[model samples]
Target: MILVLDFGGQYNQLIARRVRENHVYCEVHPHTMSLDRIREMAPKGIILTGGPNSVYQADSASCSPELFRLGIPVLGICYGSQLMAYLLGGRVETAPTSEYGKTEVTLRSGRSKLFAGVDTKTICWMSHTDYIAAAPDGFQITADTPVCPVAAMENEAENLYAVQFHPEVMHTVQGKVMLKNFVYAICGCAGDWKMDSFVRRTICELREKIGNGRALCALSGGVDSSVAAVLLSKAIGSQLTCVFVDHGLLRKDEGDQVEAVFGPNGPYDVHFVRVNAKDRFYQKLAGVTDPEQKRKIIGEEFIRVFEEEAKKIGAVDYLVQGTIYPDVIESGLGKSAVIKSHHNVGGLPDYVDFKEIVEPLRLLFKDEVRTAGRELGIPDYLVNRQPFPGPGLGIRIIGEVTEEKVRIVQEADAIYREEVAKAGVEGLGQYFAALTNMRSVGVMGDGRTYDYAIALRAVMTSDFMTAESAQLPWEVLQKTTSRIVNEVRGVNRVLYDCTGKPPATIEFE
Candidate 1:
């Protein structure tokens, strides 16, 4: 296994993900990890992640020199490269002009294994203020760029490599190729990590941990929970009970679909219970206009309901959750700042009655989760379902949420999805409709009508971190808008949201 030492970089998790994509298993640990603990895992290679600090700063983070004597391959990035240089008796200085975006690096020597198949000129995603001015006595300069002289360095004798750009990000054209070379060609990894292996190993581990004990899961009908439930069922069989609460905030036919998948005729046939607590949720959320407040209430109410159901189902030793890697990182699992408070991550109230919470998918990403789901015999329709927020339509409505607004938004959202699928628009990552509080005036067969407006959003993204607006064909939008305005009531005007994720989130509020 490969171990990635996290230095508080934003792309630390992305680096681990890339290594996994190469069919290699890896784990991320903070830089402050003790040297004795590192020796215990005995990883085949080590990767040093970048951070947002300069190496010259007195309070900057660095690794213990004893790590180099482990006789294992080591690869350092951005800040990691600077730290390696400064600690190994090399010079590191702040660049005259910091490189914050994409930059071109020119290869000086093609003999290094890291640059084996790389082109002479490659574009790299760079975000650094400090650069290596000189290599250590035994190191060789492998590449350079206009702004930085030591873009890449290597000491083949010691299996040490360093680069001043991020190879995990997709913006870097040859990033993945470089990682492939390092992991396979240089480090000699077998590349034997696959979804099947993960499934088999995880099942064995779960059985060992939850022996003869009952476990309960709160199913949200999303891909994460569905996959987690199926995994648990595979391990403990009838001992697993799934409680699905239809709080009336889900999309059209969502509850029925969940029931169909987990019912008596379904694949697993595990014990299941369905709760219709629509009125309770609506009443609790009444008079709450703030988005944060609504999310908090919804989260607390879910826990309360789950506790009530657990009592009815008898004693269970564990509570299963569908938490994934992104949820953990976004909730500040490491030194990273909390991007947002995900309900499944940080919304658990203090009134829970379970002995422990088991999250099988905590270390996997969305795509990896789906891969594992398919390996467990789940259908394609459920495994490939689009990403949905935990709070459901509560955050989709811009203003006050009422029965009328919910119905209107649900209809509009369904129509938008139907039309998009029919048009064969496969490139749009996620598409939905947001009910705006603003209304517009439109002519309805000679009558001037004023009603609520709907905003249609569609984005193209590989990772949900950054996205660009989907350039959908105008004809398709025209049909979608016409259908919503004519078929869905309380919507007079339909507008397309062209804003990306940075300026606007996928959901309105």
Candidate 2:
């Protein structure tokens, strides 16, 4: 496992993803962690992440120098590199001209261990106010950027490598390649962590834990839970019952898709239950405007439905869910101090009775989940499915989650998704459709002006923690706007979400 000492960059999670992409296991820990404790974790290597704080700041965060004694390969980035330089008796001074955004770096010595690759000139993502003017006694300077005299440094004696820029971010085109090279060349870790291997091991583990008892699973029709249901069915056939609850706020054909996956081609006995308690949900939520309250009511109602279905299944022993990693931040079900959860948080309620919970994909990220699905022979159409909120279209609607409101949001959302696919951005982070509480006035035809407004929100983000306004191609946006206004009635005007994820959230409550 590779250990990353977190100095609190928003992109720290990206650093972990980069390592995992190379088929190596990696974990992030607070920089306050001691070398002795880190050594106990037995990591293959150590990476110090960049931070908003500078090393020269008196109140700056610092870790013990004892890390060098472990004889592990160390890669320090940005602020991390500054700290290493400071500790090694090198000159770290605040630069008069701070390097931010894209910068060019030129390799100085090909013989340098850190610069063994062929590139003599490379573009890098640099954001640093402090510059390293000198290197410690045995350290050799490997490269220099347009601004910083010593952009990259290496100490072969200590097996330490440092870069003034972050290679974990996408802005650095060669960042991923550089990281892969480091994992293979420096640490001797083979990039062979295949999804097939993950499936086999997970299946074996699930079987061992679940010997001969029956299990109950909560299926939300999302990829995570659907994948979990399929995996559990494969592990213990006839011992699992899949339950899906309908609160009437679901998107168009969402329920049908759920039925298709769980009813047929399902490896085990799949039970499909639809509870239409939309009125009860809306009545309970009457005039209560808080977002958290809305989520709680939905969550509570969902649990009640699942419990009602589980009773029919005759006292199952386990509850399986498609609980993926991002669920932590999404659902806000629990506090994960590190890594914000997406809309997919905690799986069953505390009061409900079940022996033990089994989450087959709990350890896997979103990408890994889809990859594992394909490896298990699930169709790409189902496996590469777009992400949907577990609350269905309830939270996606602004005012009240009536059946009509749900239908409008679903249709608009589907249209938004269709055009986004047509836009063909290489790595679009997330997209969604939402309804507004207020209406706008407009003229439909020759005569009178009418009212109503629909919103289309989408953004590109490395991690859901922060996001940038997705500058979708104008032609695609215009086409999408035209369709929503023409095909979907009651929507006189269509507006795009230009604001990013700070002042605005992914979902407009």
Candidate 3:
């Protein structure tokens, strides 16, 4: 196993994820982890994650000095590289111009294990305000860039390496190869971590943990929830009960899809409960237009509903959620700031009575979750399903929640999805329609008509956190628009959202 020391880096979890993607297991711990703890872990290799802080700052993050003496391969990235340089008797200072995007790195000399089989000149993603001016004692400079001279350095004797550019991100085409070299060549690790093995081990552990006690899972139709439910059913069989709350905010056929997956004749043969809390949720959300407020109400109400269901089923030993790594990080599970409160993450209220919260997929990213789902024999459609927010269609509608608005958006969204599937747009992340809550005057049948405007949103993203608007073929958009205008009850007008994640989030609200 590889141990990733998190120094408050935005991509700490990403580092661990990349390691796992290479079929090697790794864990992320804080940089302040004690030396004794490191010894206890006995990881094959150590990785220092990049952070937003500088090592020279008054109270910036620093690790135990004895970490270098562990006699294990160590890799320092960005802020981590700077920290290693400053602590190891090298120079680190602020750069004249910060590098925040893609940059080129040129190999200096020698055959380094880290860059084994990599091109002499390659591109890498850079995000740092400071750079290492000099290599630490006994370290050789391996690569250099115009803006950052000491871009890569290593000491073969100590099995230590440092890089100013992020090889974990996708922009670095050969980043994963670099990681593989570190894990296999330098660290002497057996790259044998597989999803099937993870499943077997997790099931064994779950059986032991639950121990004849029953588990109640919040089985939303999303990939994470479905996978969690499938895993729990495999672990505890009938001892696990899945409660699916249809809050009247889900997409078309979403509830049916969930039922088909967990039904009696399904692969798991699990017990399931489908609660129709549509009116209850809609009544509570009546006239609420603010996005944050809507999320809060939906989150709280979801918990209350689940609490009631649990009471009905008697005492449940645990509450299972489909929480994943991004959810954990975004909810401030680590030192990272809270980006948003996910319904499954920070959305739980104080009234929950379950003895404990169980999240089997908590350490995984979205793609990782999908891999696990496929490993468990889940259907491809359900496993590769597009991401859906916990607040459901409430957030999809840009304004107040209403039955009419929900219906319009659902129908429009269904048509949009159908067209997208027909177009066979490869690598499309998410595509749907949102009710803009604004109407424009239009001429239909030679009559002036005022109807709500529908905005079609489609994005292409590997990770849901960052996305770019999908450059769908104009013909596909034309088909989607024509169908939505003609078939959906929405009287007139369809528009496409051209904005990306920075200025506009994937969801309208």
lDDT by residue (144-173, candidate 3, tens digit) is: 889898999998899999999989877777
- Per residue, candidate 1 scores C-alpha lDDT tens digits across 81-145 of 88888888899988898887779999999788998888999999888888898888899999889
Tell me the tens digit of each residue's lDDT in model 2 across 1-509. 78888786655656777898998988778898877788789888889888777787888878887786689999889988888888878889988789987788898887765556638888888888888888877888988976698898989778898999888876676887778767777878766676788899998889889999888777877778878877887888788777777667777777776777676665436655555666777676677656666766777666676667778868778878777755643443121233322323543445756777677886677788888888877778777666776766767777666666666777887888888887776566677878887786787776555645778877776545446677778888788889988888767788888986554667676
**Which parts of model 1 have CA positions greater than 4 angstroms off?**
91-95, 129-137, 287-293, 436-453, 462-468, 497-509
Name model 3 segments beyond 4 Å from true: 264-268, 287-290, 437-453, 461-468, 489-509
Q: Which pairs clash in model 3?
A: none
Clash pairs, candidate 1, are: none
Show the lowest summed lDDT stretch of 10 residues, model 3.
331-340
Comparing 1 and 2 on TM-score, the stronger one: 1
lDDT of each: 0.86, 0.75, 0.86
Candidate 1 CA-lDDT value? 0.86
Badly placed stretches (over 4 Å) of model 2 are 28-41, 50-63, 86-121, 126-137, 141-151, 264-268, 288-297, 329-343, 346-355, 398-404, 417-430, 436-438, 446-450, 457-476, 498-509
Per-residue error (Å), model 3, residue 440:
5.2
* Residue 197 displacement (Å), model 1: 1.4
Candidate 2, residue 195: Cα displacement in angstroms equals 1.5
Query: TM-score of model 3 relative to the true fold?
Result: 0.92
